[model samples]
Target: MRKHLAFAGFATALLMLAPPAVASADKPEPRVSGSMSGTLPKEFGPWAGEPVKFTIDAHGRPAGVKGTFKVFHDRIDGSKPVGDFEGKITCLAVAGEVAVATGVITKGYVNILDKPTEDVTGKKVSFTVHDNGRDDRIFWIWEFMGAPVNDCQGTAPAFKPARGDFTIRG
Candidate 1:
């Protein structure tokens, strides 16, 4: 019984000398979390006369985000082509002024063809967000600087423009 007690005491001392299992407090802070989405106004140059909608769904604090872009034509008559885009994205916060995200479209479709998604699948799309520090009335928006469509297939819009703005009002 005395030997058993000594062995147990030694084991308890060893455990006290061992390192901790996790170090969560030593890790850096995670990125902010939320979703941002909105529609492009008619004056948006690239989609001047079309109704385009954009969405940026953040996967997590660091897995980046996935975006969905769509455009619809004046179609009570069903006489126009639709544009759709979906893929992964990476965003970087500016010097306290903006958050810029850019990535390639790797999925989704446009019109009757999947060309737009395929064309830009491996290509890059740049999106920018300007937060005026006010969440009152439509101030935080992500703007598209450039997203070109290449290697198109089937019946599709000849020009793929990527100059529109998206907003998340909360």
Candidate 2:
């Protein structure tokens, strides 16, 4: 009876520790997606509004990003979209509530003085998405205007939205 009791206690301890490892292994990676539209500095003329939609799935390994980055002048409002940039996001690096996604602009276009022009092609686009409720801010790399940060790493820029909504999940 004494030997049997000791074996049962050891078995119970083993059973208790076994499930957690299995449970953790079964955990799935968080999904990443967002719809963001915000404003940039007016001093940077010809381009004033920035809108990004991150709707993608398992890209390579850990995370994926797919979205359209568009820009419009402040005067246009809801009329038309200028600088429609669509591409595959190459890198998505996250820290806390902020995520920086970077990719090359496979295809893009802009309008110069109401004339459609093929511009901003083959350029790197990196943007930051903040997922902190009210404090949430949406912003991206303005390479033409010399944005401070590029690629999806380290500290990034966060621009408070003067309009639209941003939904980011990770």
Candidate 3:
């Protein structure tokens, strides 16, 4: 009888030590998508486009980025979308010199900085999204005339960058 009792106790202890299983629903999906209307700075001459509309699509999970993104830049002539492309955001996070959050974006890593002048509700932040494979398609938000402009990327001078007014929904 004592041996049987010991065995039962061991069994109960084992069960209690076991880790609880979590359902798939418990995990939240990782996705960042939004749009913004901002300026596209002209790197060289004194030419900056007015605030324009641009969209973003980033989807993935915690610590893992397996999503895509699309960018559309309007021409100064009010003609076609001179800047545009659909690519994958292999990594996603908000981390860098500022230390906001770290994640991989469309092609490379990005450093996101929140704007103090604007409230967090408007999602005012800075972005420096670059590509790991190439440094040509990098985008960043920097202080332009006191305010931050969200368009600039290239070899000589980075052009057009919209503001970071995208809201996190998902």
Candidate 4:
């Protein structure tokens, strides 16, 4: 029918004249990535002698990632296993070369603790990366401790790693 053809042509022309869909500027830019493996200083808590390792590659925000984050710990002297935990990266706020991330511990285990799964799992955790290259420092690792710990809602103290290298990008 001529009427149908005319309507199709008009719709096509209107669509062609419409403005293109632009990317949203409100969305967060790709940022925040860190990987490190070393021993936490004795100042943290009892698990100072253990070797800990973790990796965080958070790009966007809460809704983007499913697993959130992961942390690994191993016993080097063949004694007992170190503490390990994981959860989703709920929040990541970056400033300059330092980035602070927060999430909940869904599951974990620590040799020192009697019940790491029940103690650490379901609790909140935070990690700070001061990406200064070989001299880079870890601001805080709030998950390993028990109660009365710093949440790192804003900033946490920076402690130099005793060993291992760090590759943090912000």
Candidate 5:
């Protein structure tokens, strides 16, 4: 029958040029933690007991930093806490560093007056620290006054910390 209809038209043109099979869908990776407090700029008194804990991965940059600062005796009568710090944080961002922090005060500051002793360390001092993710809101910049200010600022929810931390990582 004409070579079996040309072999069924070449097997229906090789099943219409074959090629059709796909199944793929998987994408989800981005996590961040939170928790922060501010107020601790008496010129860092002198390491104010050794306060400087940081950790930002996910891409933020900074990866890890320990803690410990001390330097009392500068109470102009503000009461206390002239220099109190804390620590704790994790990282995971690569290439230069993106942003990823866990928790624990990033930067601190306290000196409104009414009893604000007077530890302007060196000068430049601002507060408003706290950022969990998506742009929490941070803005601390304790420069000169004590030297070694860590800056921070966000938008979503809140993440602010820029007044003194010395930021340093690799």
Candidate 6:
């Protein structure tokens, strides 16, 4: 009779300590996608200016050119894109033709960068435009610029376009 009581107590304890069985199998992970778009202001400065309003298409192409400018992204610390900019008219004309255009993220803000990394073969000093858009090829570039560490930190940096150079292309 004592053995029966001990066995009953042991079974009760085991039942209480056992974990509940899972109801179903684990669900699959979710897939994420990135997007880009914006508008360019009628007047703006390439540097030393505020964020100009520009309509950046989903394909990452800039239209309405009033002046000569070139835009591209640069990888900072070999980790991710930290900065990008639209080059001056003279620079863009000399750099090369616009082969491909696409929107991308370096640190966080939407930016346009080169399509083929192999095409951007140059000294890593400043942003350079490798492809010209005259060819009419659709390109897409997207990257996640990490979030800020603190409130004191500023938002992601982006390239500024000079005023009187905004022109829309067909």
Residue 23 Cα positional deviation in candidate 3, in Å, after optimal superposition: 14
Q: Report the C-alpha lDDT of model 5 over 29-145, residue by residue, as the tens digit.
A: 333333333333555444233333223322233433322222222244445544443333333221121232323333444443254544343333233323323333433333424
Candidate 1 lDDT tens digits, 14-35: 9999997863655433222233
In model 4, state the lDDT of residue 7: 100
Q: Rate the local accuracy (lDDT) of all candidates.
A: 0.40, 0.55, 0.40, 0.64, 0.35, 0.28
Best by TM-score: 4
Give the winner by lDDT: 4
Per-residue CA lDDT of candidate 3, range 1-170, in tens? 99999999999999999999753655545444555555655643323663345455665544565544454545566644433334444444432211111222222211223323321222222333332122212343323224543312112213333344343423
What overall lDDT, based on C-alpha atoms, would model 4 receive against the true structure?
A: 0.64
Each prediction's RMSD over C-alphas, in Å, is 15.3, 9.6, 15.7, 12.6, 16.9, 19.5
| Pairs with steric clashes in candidate 4 | 68-88, 68-89
Models ranked on TM-score: 4, 2, 1, 3, 5, 6
User: What ranges in model 5 sit over 4 Å off?
Assistant: 1-78, 91-101, 105-167
Name the regions of candidate 3 deviating beyond 4 angstroms: 1-29, 41-47, 94-165
Scored by lDDT, model 2 comes in at: 0.55
Better of 1 and 3 by TM-score: 1
Model 4 C-alpha lDDT per residue in residues 1-170, reported as the tens digit of each score: 99999999999999999999864677455356656667766775766666777776665533453225677777657665666677767776667777777777777755665644434777777777777767877654554564433433645536676555544333
Give residue 66's error in model 6 in angstroms: 41
Tens digits of per-residue lDDT for model 2, 78-167: 545555656666676655576676666666665445675657666776667677776667556745434554556434455665544544
Point out where model 4 deviates above 4 Å. 1-30, 42-45, 61-67, 113-119, 141-144, 148-157, 162-170
Better of 4 and 5 by lDDT: 4
